[model samples]
Target chain A: MLRRAASILAISALVLLVAGMGISAQADVIVIGEIAALTGPTAQQGLQERNGAVLAVEEINAAGGVLGKQIKLITYDFKGQPAEGVSVYRKLVQQDKAVVIVGTNFSNVNLAMAPVAEQLKVPVLSNAMEPAVTTPEPGKVNKYHFLAQPSSIEQGAIVARYALDELKFKTAACLVNKGNSFATSQAEAFRDYFNANGGKVLDYIEVPAGAVDFKAQLTKIKASNPDCIYIPQYAQEAGLQVKQARELGITAVVLGANTLGVPPFVEAAGSNAIVAGTYFINNVHFGDPRLADFMARYEKRYGEPVITTNVFFGYDNVYIIKAAIEKAGVAEPEAIRTALENTKDVKILQGAGTITLDPNTHRPVDMPAWIFKWEADGTTVPMTLMYP
Target chain B: MLFQQIVNGISVGSMYALLAVGFSLVYNILGIANFSHGAMIALGAFFSYWIARYLAVPVPVAILASIAFTGLSSALVELVTLRILRKRGQGSLYFFIASLTVFNLVTAVLVYISRGNIVSYPRAFLSGTFTIGNLYIPWIDAGMLLISIVCLAVLSYVMFKTRFGLAVRAASFSIKAAQLMGMDIDAIIQGVFFVSGTLAGVTGALLGVKYAVYPYIGNFVYMALFACVVGGLGNLTGAVLGGLLIGLLETLVSAYISSAISPALTFAFLVVILLLRPQGLAGRATEEKI
Candidate 1:
């Protein structure tokens, strides 16, 4: 009879322990994950992303939380590598139990994470400009990844149009980093658009990544005597190319992708004069009245002035996730994925208009790419906003 | 256009020559690749940049000071890591690994300090290009070429003419024989390291001016390794020849062929050459005395 009593006690304890585990697992907190290159060559942009997301989460949490549950952000540093990016995506989903994910400015990393997102049944909102991150093949969607910024396709054509219609450049030469899919996609898009629009693309040069010296390629471009040179690369290479181009006496108008507008590009160029008259296609519209408040709050929170467009991306992506979660009305991964697909008319701090993802492509639609010209004082002045 | 490309090649090749020769120096004596040489290169650049920017010293003086400091640091690295390992009777592989560890540790520290930002000099020096007929050459490239030639000449004189050079050469033949002849092996090894470090330092400073200063700027050591291997790993003259050839090939290939595949093509070419002459271009096969 005593042995039977002890057995009953052990069974009751096991049942209570299982019930407690379930209760704790269903605690009143919503988990979200952010993956970024927090410590690598692109850390500057990553730092901005982290700061922006942190600010958004704080504001949301202070405003009585989202769906009556305090939002908890789990951030992972991929260190700018695609392999690490995949590993972190798994950790965020499987380990952190996050319902929705955001971040990664690198196109390659985003591309690597898309398939994993689909398998994990989690939705990823990325700022990576590569169109392939959402649509891996033409007319085929990845069903999980969403892009918050204008794709490289739109930005490239906008740049080409601005060059030909606004600046009236007759001939151009394209220089791209072959190693970077982001750069190559933009370069190729520009080449296609320029050629289709009756502009002469004198030569398309694919430069190996990390080739600090560009005199050899610049000499060939100079010999060709094009009226303009299109450089689509990240800030480090962009600054070096412009500085070297000016040194080599290539007086052609310089056109670049969005990455060229960052402070690192200016810092890398050394003097503002070298970058003066150079224009790059960007999504940020500094003159937009909505940004004044955002900029002020960002500075107050981070103790540093805004330097890159990535800050906007970080802030906007979090709002995108929040909107999806509210629409879903439940902190479940599958429900959030479904809700994210139906997102429409969401407001965010980027582009010249509201953020809306195309239901079919999972990419931002009708977003305008603005042309920004570098001033003599190391500031970028917005010239005109163009839409695809 | 051809002349201009050739000029560009020479400018690029000269930088590689400085690095390869310095890299070959330690290898000739120690029979091991000193990977820390890359860190010394990065340290040299950062040192010059910091002095020139923060202290407001003249660029030339900054370069000299950086050269001295980096040389001493290189010697110190040898004294601490390799010297200790050698005293412990470690194999060549341990020395190589320890050198690599030093390189990685230094790079990581630089990354932490700089926060992964690429910085240029506060004031432009050797910037802008001057035209000679139809050929346009950036002043920085011209300066690098001139400095590299002068350094090579001085190094050649020291290695061929000086008593210290005699000891190094003797030690290279046989460390045991040199010791029996009353040579201090430790001192000779340290001296070689100092000389090698000085070369790496100047190269680093020039490279920083030409490009931008970043933690990963030391990756140029790959070019040095390639040149050393192609020219016969321990032959100084071979290193210079190999550097110029590789530089010229890279320039011409990128100019005429697809830049995307130029590096791959260059590596393939190196492989073919290596297969043809396993001892490399200038290496002489020497039998062990047993």
Candidate 2:
């Protein structure tokens, strides 16, 4: 009778174990697809966006994941190409069945991915700061679309203010790449403010990108005798201009957009001659004493100091996702989106910077743009803290 | 002041001549464009950058190694991408397509391997400014000019004086014919690729050391393409002249008209030349020889 009772207990335990395993398997992990120009021209930008997303996901998982299950972030390569970005987004939605997506660092690529996201009704958190991403028809845009970064208009206006108030330049020359959204928007903002502020407009030079040299623009800038030259271009082309300008003895403040803060621009331009300052709406400021802990953890993992906001963006993004998941209290997309929208003051990377959401703007609450200058020793130093 | 722009043109032109000559040699000898030529260029720079970052070699030694690495990579390309596909019945179309795919794959593989970080040379290589007259010559530009002349002179001597070089010339003319004569055809062909690849590598290294190295940077070789076109595709002398001329043209455009139209000027020149004289600057047309 004891032997029979023991056998019954063992079989019952086995059944119970199997049933528990079956129930756990039923709670499926929701796939979150991320597409970025992980490689190609403008690669650094893509890298930052991808890094930010990756870090966010990791933090999300570390903080008990989303819903009762862990998120599966499926990343795809679009190589900064519009068509490729579209295809990648489609694949993520149709084949991968990713509940939500974020991607495409380039404005054009982001715009391309927008239609696909709208058609599929998948909430897309675009990292592209292009003005068009928010306003599709200049006024009409999708309600579900969200952007982590502020618009190019804000970036342009901030830069314009810096050039006028801070730099105190009389005449400024503008080197605008006629092809890109960042260049065009910044150029517009600079024009509106600089001229209105009683500064002489030297020359509005439109340079076609990848044209090898910028001697003509330099010559024009030289002739105009501008106190400064505003370049709303990335580091690759921007480096060439700064180098060429200095080469021609045209000593003027060469200002650039936030993209200029990257290492390639500094390396390309060299140190002493080409001085540049840029604004970034980053969550983590390098000078933040609160970031000391985050930095320690980051350095411990990567074996290097996190100087730029690139790594911080990734690290904080992870926490943002974590907060959203916690708010949702479930892994469901609708619940997660609500949680993300409701996320406020949930600090992970920096002990500061509240992640507040306003229903009117449909972006994070009161993003701050900080200025950083490349130091003599090849280190990016925090210059000014700003709210835009 | 205008003189300064001209000098700038010459410096950049030298770089193109450096790149175009190697490309022209590969095209002439192999009877194939060797589209993966960019890989050799990039690798040369990659090697130089690595040397600067890790070993901290002087620029001169780095240049030499860049050439050798590029040459070896070129030979490797032939081994992996060309040799198997080469057949009597088959033309260069097979090699061309295979290598185009090879080019894309190599680029993809390189990027995947590096995770697309911009690998740059140490700043010490090209930091100071050397002033000659009113013109301020940057150390980097000065270094590029010196390197170009040294490589070009050495290449000339090798091609004219050395027996290995003669074999190379023979192989390029007609591989079968050269084989029929007393010559090791395979060795000659391999040597051509190696030599040509080395030249491209040197150019790439120079570019990386002086400027910066991200992935696929060789695509920005503006002067090389124009030089190739102007030099009649496979002519060495023509390549040099073409590179220098285009370099000057670009500088002039940048100095006077607009820097934005410099690339457009190159294409416009190509179109005009093609329409008027498709045979090229020094390219011969032998239709109905008397």
Candidate 3:
């Protein structure tokens, strides 16, 4: 008799929960979804991205939201896995009824979600660096996917240009993780550009992903005596490389991608002195005048200073969606897609200035990569900026 | 350069040796793999890191504290999981599965608690490098090599010269027979786990000092398992040999050959050696006494 009563109570609770969600669904608000790596190896970046987006939503609703309707964000954790990314994308589209999806910063996850986004006919804006996330084949574009940041090809070109033209590096060595598409593409692009621009590549070393020890590779690179070394890897591996390279007495100028411009990398290096002389190309500058208000608001909300440029990626993506929603003048997914394709001169954060989406490839057009150096005091100072 | 690479190999190999020896201890007597040893390693690292950071203790002292704590934790794991299974007359497969489950469970809990952040020690311990001729050796690598050697020496003395070691050997031969000879079987097993866990704690703490500390640092168990298998299962000396061989092979292969296929080449080499030896590098063929 008690068991039967308990079952009835449980059923009633579930019914009430569903009914509550249904009432909220009918409210005068537009639901946008985010799939991020909230708990995994890359959780640091994911959490920052979420915080940035949430801050934007709070500020937007405070000033009255887009299209005369308040914005509601529904976020799900992908755990930095490609399979989980796809499942969450499906849930965000089918069950949550999100008009548009802001996807993960992991290139592999974005690659997996690209096809799903097209089939579901919901546009996905991502900061994943892989160029293949937006363009799958030659002269073929994944129409439903949009990249908010510069792609790997563009980032590689910037690095190569900086090394060859600005830094005046004559000979370089490449240390790339072949197992990761992001690292592989960036390394290949850098190599091609550097060679074409009259710079010599001493040796291109391929390190398998997740192999922590790089002393052997660094020793080889040191023996070759390159003017600079390119380390196109995520922060953790890049940090390890930097630490080990210093230990092995390789004093070549170390250059890395956007992922290396975060606090986690510095922390992982154990001492800031290890990374003091290193250079990395990033998308956003925390010192930019445009980010003063955003930075203050972010620190006030999160009780911590901004750690990575991922914050800007998340913040800018929401504003991009808001612009599309206002231009479309409707709270429908299809209309938002059309408006996003025609997006132009929309400013939020990062890039050279205002963001303009390419009609042909659905990616940000001509975004500049900002180069920064890590000072001995553990602070990043802007060196210069490069555009491609 | 070659001498430096060799030194690097030996340093890395010693770490693998420490991990393999710790893993092999529980397996030798229990006749089952304790996959939870990996979790114990991660726990040791995080525990020492927390102690050193929050309590402002010396790193070496913090490491000693973590060793004791993890030793107790390992015995507790056995008290809850394997002991219950053993009481139920369960097979080795069940114990293996339980151990694997415990590893995953511990990893998940750590992820939740830490939010999956990769953190390093507040102060660098055993960092920087010094040059001898043309060879550069990081201080941490030398420290790890020294610590591993000292621990292995002490472990050897205990295992070969002590009364408890005699009991452990007897238990490995036959648990029923050991009990018949007036040994408390449960106590003996618990003691072995404590010793093994202590070793794991030391290894993990040193590794955290060498690299960085993260929840996934336990994934190094794959290297430990490989070393244990290639050396000879249940053989402490073989585990050390296997570790050194694998580490040296990996470092040399990556240095001279293609780094891209080094892992594949290492495994292929292991497979060839196994095919030739059949019973592993150190194992002797013998009939089942049971």
Note the DockQ of each predicted structure.
0.68, 0.38, 0.76
lDDT for each residue of candidate 3 in A1-388, tens digit (9 for 90 to 100): 9999999999999998998889577578889999888887778788888998998888889989986789999989998789899999999888888889997788889899999888999889998888899899878988889888888888988999999998999999999998888898888899999999999999899997789888878889999999999998999889989999999899999999888888778878777899998888998888999778878989999999998777887898999999999999998888998899899999878967689989788888888879989998998899887888
For model 1, residues B1-290, the per-residue Cα lDDT tens digits are 88888987888888888899999999899888899999999998899999999999988889899999999999999999999998998888998999999899989999988888898888878988898887778899999989988999999899899999988998899888998998999999999999999999999998989888899988888899889888888889988988887888788787877677778988888899889976778887743320
**Candidates sorted by DockQ, descending order?**
3, 1, 2
Give one digit per residue, the lDDT tens place, for model 1 in A22-84. 648757888889998788777988888888888899999999888998888888999878999
Q: In model 2, which regions exceed 4 Å deviation? A: A1-31, A37-72, A177-179, A209-212, A270-284, A300-304, A315-352, A355-366, B79-89, B132-134, B161-177, B220-225, B254-262, B286-290
Candidate 3 CAPRI assessment class: medium
Q: How well does candidate 3 match the true structure, expressed as C-alpha RMSD?
A: 2.5
Ranking the candidates on lDDT from highest down gives: 1, 3, 2
Q: What DockQ results for candidate 2?
A: 0.38
What lDDT would candidate 2 get against the real structure? 0.70
TM-score of chain B of 1: 0.97
Instruction: Report the error of model 2 at residue A165, Å.
Output: 0.6
B1-290: candidate 3 lDDT, tens digit per residue: 88888988888888999999999898788777888888888988999999999999988888899999989989998899888998899888998999899888888888888888788887668889988988999998889888888989998888889999988888888888998888999999999989988888888888888888888888877788888888988889888998888989898899999888889998999999888986668866633322
Which sections of candidate 1 miss by over 4 Å? A1-26, B287-290
Share of real interface contacts recovered by each model? 0.70, 0.31, 0.73
Task: Per model, state how many residue pairs clash.
Answer: 0, 6, 0
Stretches of candidate 3 off by over 4 Å are A1-27, B286-290
True contacts kept of 3: 0.73
